[model samples]
Target: MNMLDYIDWRGDLTFEQDGFNEVDNLVFSELAYTDMRDIVPEDGSRALTVAQVYGEYKAAGIDQSLMMNDPLPVLEKAAQSPRFKDITVKWYVDKIDTEQHLQFAAVTFIISDKLAYVAFRGTDNTIVGWREDFNISFLSETPGQTEAVAYVNRIAKLTDCKLIVGGHSKGGNFAVYACAFCDKDISEKRVIKIYTNDGPGFMNEVAESENYLSILSKTIKISPDSSPVGLFFLSKAERKVIKSDSKGFMQHNPYKWHVLGAEFESADARTDPFINMTISSWLNTMTDSNKKILVDYIFDSLEASGVTSFNELADNKWNSFNSIFKALTKIDPNDKTDIASSIKKLIASGKDVVISEKQKNAEIKKAEKNKVDNEKQE
Candidate 1:
């Protein structure tokens, strides 16, 4: 059973009867997708129930559909679910600062007693949203992440409940970051769990910090079997892979993930380690300066196509295609390598990484074989 199915079957169970689990975390994470700007409070003083949020959201006639992911159906069901219907929500923060290159939104869910789930909203289909995601590659600290820390710190002051910081996609990255970098007292005492669902990991500098590792014992890193996003940079937290009906990049969608009785169905397989290694090799090989140039080249071209979001770019694929390339020609060649040279380097790097990986695998197998033979002798 997926989230919607889980809601249908277990909707009647309240938090007291059935305490919050990983599945509920995913539910709350998706709840953040709903545009509850005015319907939800920002100061943590006022709050709204899930049912009320859905009512106001529907009454306001907000666009319920985006390019790929749509939360309307799940949200409607959540509003009706006993588990979520009356869940108190507050301190909604949604910001898209183009100047700062940040796209962040988050909300908190009060389940029962003194428990609160701080859910970070995943990336929406905005240009800046996707841009901020790529920006993480070159920049160590993003404006979005900094905001997450502040948001969590402020929210911590308002509530005494144990915080369960969680999110999907880039939001998951923020969840971990916020928990790690928030007030040390909160990170050590207040935070009960940190869930990052298919979220990318931090750079070496951030991931290796004492703060990040301080909460590593509480962090749960989940990914799909063929996950593309979850494998990037990776995390030291105990990682679990879930089965997904969808394949390839499409597995990033939460709905496609398979659910067991209450938990995600475990996968017997993992994605090609080679692909993840290749990506790691490529990024590690590229200088930070080059990464900036590549990112600017791609996004600047897309924006030049007279489109701000992927939805706008896809509405008329033919015209946007021509315009994006036209914008590329206007870029300074001294800043970016020629297409042929860049492609050649990409191919060469992949080959070298693959060969190196194979040699390492062979050595690992030989060592294992040697240990088995020694045991036989004993």
Candidate 2:
């Protein structure tokens, strides 16, 4: 039986399938918990419950039977296998079906996709702020991106058809990286287009390479109108701007991508304002040597801190400067220069650093109150 049949074939596991082929509802009968469905839940509060899985199926309305039955066990089997298994960056590969050529690579199965989906969990190997005592390391490399690049290359070597390279968030960035860095034959043969769906822009090290430039024409970056990811890594490359119904988290959802007649409203989106400002602030605020030192310190601190996932380390609140500082410190903690101190000094340099809508409103209100008071006195 297929993974789908194995997981949901029981009498109690009944659910109506939507016209979109998405599950409208999932009922877990007693007979549905087969051996193939067994999976060790992730530690802490990050674990996915059975009901949650069903809920995701209902919400996404996408096929996930193969992923559900095969992913976790396949990962377990692959790890225990003596061949093609390594503990580095926690690698696992599973086949969708023995008869089919489909496969999946996972980073602990936090999210599962029905089709080809790749994503990078940012801050995978870096600690930030108060997560030190939570038994999570903020230092370590996510070898998955490198492996994915290699995988794409291997797939290209086997096929000559146009390959649709795509990913969301960090995975989207990696898709671009792999397309750029892969062998020339692969680049020429099958890599027709790359869809970076709200992915982080490349780091400074790889931004200007010729390989990256080669695929610029084929690279299409799609992001929400006001994107948080774009605010970190700025790029002037190909951009497709989208509008989201909800702000922040809602914008990140693919479903929110505006679909017009034959195209979305992605023609005008460009680099993020925040990224430009940060890079500019860094350059204008400090000397070249200090910039070098600070950037290096941040990279090294993050590398040394070693975190496995962002869910373990991220704070409930969002502060741009603090977020960047945490990322840098996790990369290189040994650099003695204090990131917060430097940022504070830079902010004190008579710069317009604050972008506050509320503050602006308050100023307008105060001005109106003073005008009324002056009229009364007159």
Candidate 3:
């Protein structure tokens, strides 16, 4: 079954939903153990509530190690079930932190015939929530090295585990971080391929670490054509990037990522030099000032008008969009009614405009050619 299907049918300690005949019951049982009864009403019908479940574990006085480590047995049991029928299957759940936030990662294992797969899910706030409150600038916190990371290390130690890791957004980032910081013995055991579907990267301090260097050989970073989270600065030891089709802000969503046919049909699925150059150019031009101004305007618009989301801001009678633009431009958020007109004039004047795609490619090609010529001259 697909990842979405697995999530949909996931109920309290069970998978009672239909169209799940092919999956093993033991797998469902193991998943069921992740349930928290208080999360859903007494109805007991909602999908697993991750934070609530984790809280229950905390209240029960389960030591972090036992709480985090217990998932291994559940997964191992599921793998041993007859339904796997000689297929290589494993289950693992772990917690990891980048020192800023605690993250619980649920990883599914399916290894058979040399093909290994790991599907991960990110818990916590959603991007839409962040976008609405977009004034936060860059993420200040990294997932801490709490019990979560230790748990992840335990799973990574599994012998004979090959590579195949996938996660949406933050989960993708966690998967990469785990693979990067794993103990050498565990690191050598698995991690052949990593699929970071539109996940954000760590700050330069974390991304360029010695631990990160070890796994740079096998990494695939994919981003939507016009992703917001994927637009931050990253320094990779090597280049292995994949491009997807979902342009504009829609690319941040996995549903959109999957729309590209088998997960890449609706997406461009290209690693074109031109695309890379265009992105680099924009990154170069979009300075911290631009980010701060835009984010500050978002904050002002939200605060001044008591608006919660973009939709609410749009619905408010304050001409919020223009107000935000004016705030960003430092002109006047509550100026004349010609907000759009003023913005058009600013663009025409080339004040805060980002570099164009064509210009970006030209610059990249010129740099490459210059490097080649310099080497020859030397």
Candidate 4:
């Protein structure tokens, strides 16, 4: 059963009875995607119960066109569940600055009297959000990352409660970043754990920092067997591979993640080596400046289409494509050429890696066969 089923089966049990498990962690992480900015206070001075947020959501109904995934079902489930019904939610903050290509959202869940979970919202379907995500490969910290660290520090100072920070997708990246770089004294004392569920990694500078090393043991990184984002950059923290029902990019969806009882079904290793290698090699080819330029140019082209969200782009496909095509014509010829050449090089690198791996496997087989033949001769 998946998380929804787990919630139904174990809903009645309190934290005291079941204790906080990985299933609960994932449920909270996914719930981070819920848009709670309207219902909860920004300063977090006022506390709203889970039931209240669920009621507000039901009254408002759903808007499927929004960039974020629908959180209504998860809200309803949480409201019904005794485990989460009385949880106090506050400090809801959602920011989307198209000019800066930034999308950052987060909320705090006070699960117990002394325990709180800070969840960072991942990249929504907004073109800006996706652009900010790509910026991570080049920028040391995006605006979202900076805001996340401040948010955590604010919450930590407000309450002495033990903190668990987590997020799914890009949000997961924020969670780790906040924990790694926040005030060392506060984080080292109050932050108990950090969870990154299928989130991308930071650039080498951040990953190799002394701050990251200090909290590496407290961090938990989980990726599906076919993850592309989670395997981005180098991860120095403990990693876990979970089974997913979906394939390719769809596996990145938290709903497709498989769970058995209280925990996710674990995989021995990542299932898609070719994808892993291809992405790694492509990223290796681009310098930080190149990545920054590519991300800016791509997002600028998307914006030129006059579409903010992926939904809008998909709905008006012909117009969006035409607009982007027109915008491409306005770009510097050298930049356009460089972009095309880079893509070709990336594709070639992937092909080369595949061929190299195949050749290495063949050599190993031949060597094994020769050893067996010599043994027979003896």
Best by TM-score: 4
Cα lDDT, all candidates: 0.79, 0.41, 0.44, 0.79
Per-residue lDDT of 275-361 in model 4, one digit per residue for the tens? Answer: 655565557667786676666665787798788876666566567656655665676776665565555554354344334434544
Per-residue accuracy of model 3 over 88-150 as CA lDDT, tens digit each: 223444443322224454544333434445555543332133342222224433433232245
Over 109-167, each residue of candidate 2 has an lDDT whose tens digit, in order, gives: 21122222222222121222112211111111124446557767665543334555665
Q: Provide the TM-score for each candidate, comma-separated.
A: 0.86, 0.46, 0.45, 0.87
Query: Which stretches of model 3 miss by more than 4 angstroms?
Result: 1-104, 112-116, 123-141, 144-148, 157-160, 235-246, 258-378
**Clashing residue pairs, candidate 4?**
122-171
Q: Model 3, residue 372: what's the lDDT?
A: 100
Residue 222 displacement in candidate 2 (angstroms): 1.0
Q: lDDT by residue for model 1 over 1-378, one digit each (tens)?
A: 788898998889998998888888888888888887888868766778889988898999987465235677778999998888998989999999876888999999887658999989888877778878878877888999999999899888888899999999998999999999999999999999999999988777888889898999999988898877777764788888898887656688898888887789898657665455556554666667776766676666666666676556545555755664565566677654534244344435424433443454466579879999999999
Clashes of 1: 0
TM-score of 4: 0.87
The TM-score obtained by model 3 is 0.45
Q: Which ten residues in a row have the lowest lDDT in candidate 3?
A: 63-72
Off by over 4 Å in 2: 1-144, 234-236, 248-250, 267-338, 341-378
Ranking by TM-score: 4, 1, 2, 3
lDDT of 4 at 150: 97
